[model samples]
Target: MKVVVRVKLLPSPEQAEALQATLHACNRAANAASGVAFTTGATHKFALQQHVYAALKVKFGLSAQPAVRVIGKVADAYTTRTAHLDKGLLGHKGSKRRARSEATPIRFRPDSAQPFDDRCLSWQLDARTVSIWTTRGRMKNLAFTGSPDQLKALAEHHQGESDLIVQDGMWFVSATCEVPEKPLNTEPTGFTGVDLGIVEIATTSTGQRHAGRILNRYRRRQNRLRAKLQKKNTKSTKRVLKRLRRRESRRARDVNHMISKSIVERAERTGHGIALEDLKGIRGRARQAKRNRYTLHSWSFAQLRDFLTYKARRAGVPVVVVDPAYSSQSCSECDHTSRRNRPSQAVFACTGCGVVMHADTNASRNLARRGEIVWNAGRSVSRPCPSL
Candidate 1:
């Protein structure tokens, strides 16, 4: 139910530097605290808060309690539930001991700020107006600007509006008050099978295909630029490298968002639940030829999967991941399983039934079959069967 609303901060250059410095200090303190917690068996949040408080007190003369509160918020992030354990573990590690460039702006809050405005709650818009009792006096109606959707989303969650204090260029707002509603239960009309591949990003059982040509091209260009930058070792080359890295990351994210949105829309329109390969530990299990290591490493399979998951969740559609064992090799027609079934990357032929199909299409069908099995397992005798 916790959703992150990322907004661009319009801060001056000096403010940006100050924010960056604060983030770095926070990271170092968090790391030091985590190490202490690990060795002493102290509470993680308390340990982190103590370190942050000490550091902020010494460096910036900031009050100990607020600094402690900030660190406590970071520690609280560790407790949030995630589908992927590795990501949560990585987050914990990063929170305590972040690399130089990995530091980001953040803040924590205990509760919502007050004026008790009804318009904000009614229109699902964040009360752009709020009163904060500052040290000097009461500051009134500070503008809270961000994405309209994000603001509305936040307002919908929190009945009361809170003023997010801008400290060191970061907006520290309270967490949403209301948990997101559970997805509605509706009998699925059909199922959409999704096959994820290295070449073709995704292929649907409905014969819709999304090619990864543009993504691949962008990656290749990025690699070439990286190589050139490494060889040049000049200041200009470094700047170019930074720009290229940012461009590549933005492009990749954009592509993944588009792909995920398209898939979710298709499933929603057809009133079908989406079925995908359960690619747990897939990256660890992937085998690569010596020459293909770079290609394999650059592939953003995890990112795409994450995008699909969140998008499906937001759209109130169910997405099931089926066991991927022999999805490519097993014949969807005769259920015959062998390495020979997939003679090439693009083709699949059943040995027993002589059924020929596109490799991706066959995998999609297999995924659909697995989904049906899962759906059946949950079904009760009293419930009506889906009209497939």
Candidate 2:
């Protein structure tokens, strides 16, 4: 599997200036390439590269490799846009938003991330430094730092291009690493079903609950602060808003990592597969009041799912996704299903069988049962014929 390991770059002021200039030049070249691609309708990589390669080197002071990278980035952006259009992410056919998106040329931010291949960037894992090409010239021995695990991964498996990104005035290099996965466990003892919800971030069929109340409180406070800052509408307020946004994101990411690690480790240790809800398009399908919409949208269910998937894959743990419909309202014990079973957010009472349980736990148990049924059905089909 390909994983990205990000390391912080601690550069001198002059080096920072050079890096900034290089990024600006690259993005400027990208914007120009996008314009040509849009006007001429030559959006593929080679077609766009032919038109912009020579011009980028002459006009933007980019080298051959950087110029090519800029063109490739523009082409990739167009490719992504085309895919989104095909998937109707922007809007349906004849929608004003779709037409407006299709009409305009794509633009790049001045400090957007730029990729550097081996020719442009070299890493010294032992020295914790990197030699990279810059607009000023080649920069050598630029110091970097990362966590022990991240450094180890980079040293052992780092491959392909690394992206130079500036976020909140900090420089970072995100290096791609190709890590090997363990052999998958085809025969699992059982399955652990995890129910994801707003109140409780995760609840497992094994009677484990990861509450989200603290995180929710923090997010609510952050939201209030953001509103206040927006009301002020001052330069300093904008800076504060950016910092707060980054901090909140980091906090949420850390929490999700911890939660996922614990869940994956337990499943691996117990020789069990993971069961999850297939909750795609949840935001579009679900509706809430104006005030509660922020809370609903702010839930990081997708991120948690992604983390679980990759971690489980690495641990050779099988993961099954089942339909989430009525998972909460259905009775885990009696197989009864009704909307009234969930009389409240936390309680689940089956009117048919009078079996009561925690709402999230009941949902998780239902997911586990569904996952086992699916897994068994597949096993039976895939089972080998009897010896003749």
Candidate 3:
């Protein structure tokens, strides 16, 4: 399993500037290569690598090995993205679309100045030291490391993963270690239905809900600052705007981590799988919603789903994505479907069954039903009784 461990770089000012310069050069190389690929209709991985290699040597004055590494990274991204698109996993884009691939240009953990092993691309960390390697050299137990307990705690929290990649001014690191070959076994005894919403980040089928009021506050503050920055049009404004963007991202990630963790824990304890909407076509559908478009646009449904998926996978729980056709409108009790079932955001009143329940809960129950069906189809087991 690939994991990234991130530690603050206590580098001198000169070293920091040098790292930034390297990142800028790398970005420039990637962008140039992407543009070349788009214009030449050379979407193949090898063609993109050739262009990047040429650009790096002639334009950036990089050496042979470094150039190869950079190009190789870009090619890998291109190949991965192409596969995703081919598999209908990635969204469709115009033919003129360019690949803005980001890669780990520099390594900055287990003490700075140590280079990365291009082939291995990951490091192993224990209580006392970290091991890193490169094509030319390897380093072991680089001195002046952090507290062993702290490191261990971080490792345990992340599940034993260690790798760091710098991309787009942010460090993308694998946060978990040992990905189990098979996720923890979960019996489809019950289903935890999750409703992703803008205001309340998630409303579970189990009547548990998580609100994103704090996240919204941070977003509002960021938006206001961004607006002011645009109006000011000054260098300082730009700097502030950049910081705000980072701050907002951190806040969103924190909230997502907490919410995803809670949902996974709940599912694991209950021996159930999670049910969520397959929000693949949501963007196009939202575009047609017009005045009510904000509801869908503001919802971080995709992020929430992704979070739940990986978290559940790591915890050995199952997550089921159901057809969201009429989950909101269908009555959970009698299977009555109609537009009148969901009279409002919070209320669900069934016309045929005379059943009334919280709108979120009702949707969750419907999701649970779908999850049960999916589970039974996959496993030849007797249907489990509904809990909610």
Top of the candidates by TM-score: 2
Clash-forming residue pairs, model 1? 31-96, 113-162
Clashing pairs in 3: 3-163, 4-163, 4-174, 5-163, 117-134, 159-177, 160-177, 161-177, 184-316, 193-205
lDDT per residue for candidate 3 within 1-388, as digits (tens), equals 3334455333345444544555455555655665666566564667766556666777865555555555555555566766776765544453322222222122213221212333323334543433333322443443224446445645565453233345335433333434343456656578888877666788888878888777777777676778878999999988777666566666777788789999888888888889887878777865534645644565566777888888788777888888878898988899989998877877999999899888877887888889878777877768789999
Give the winner by lDDT: 1 or 2: 2
lDDT of 2 by residue, 276-324 (tens): 9999999999989898999999898999999999999999999999998
Q: What lDDT would each prediction earn against the true structure? A: 0.64, 0.93, 0.64
lDDT of 1 by residue, 47-120 (tens): 65654466655654334443564455455544432222356543555465443213422222322121212332
Overall local distance difference test of candidate 2: 0.93
Best by lDDT: 2
Off by over 4 Å in 3: 24-67, 78-115, 118-150, 153-176, 181-183, 287-295, 380-388
> How many steric overlaps are in each model, in order?
2, 0, 10
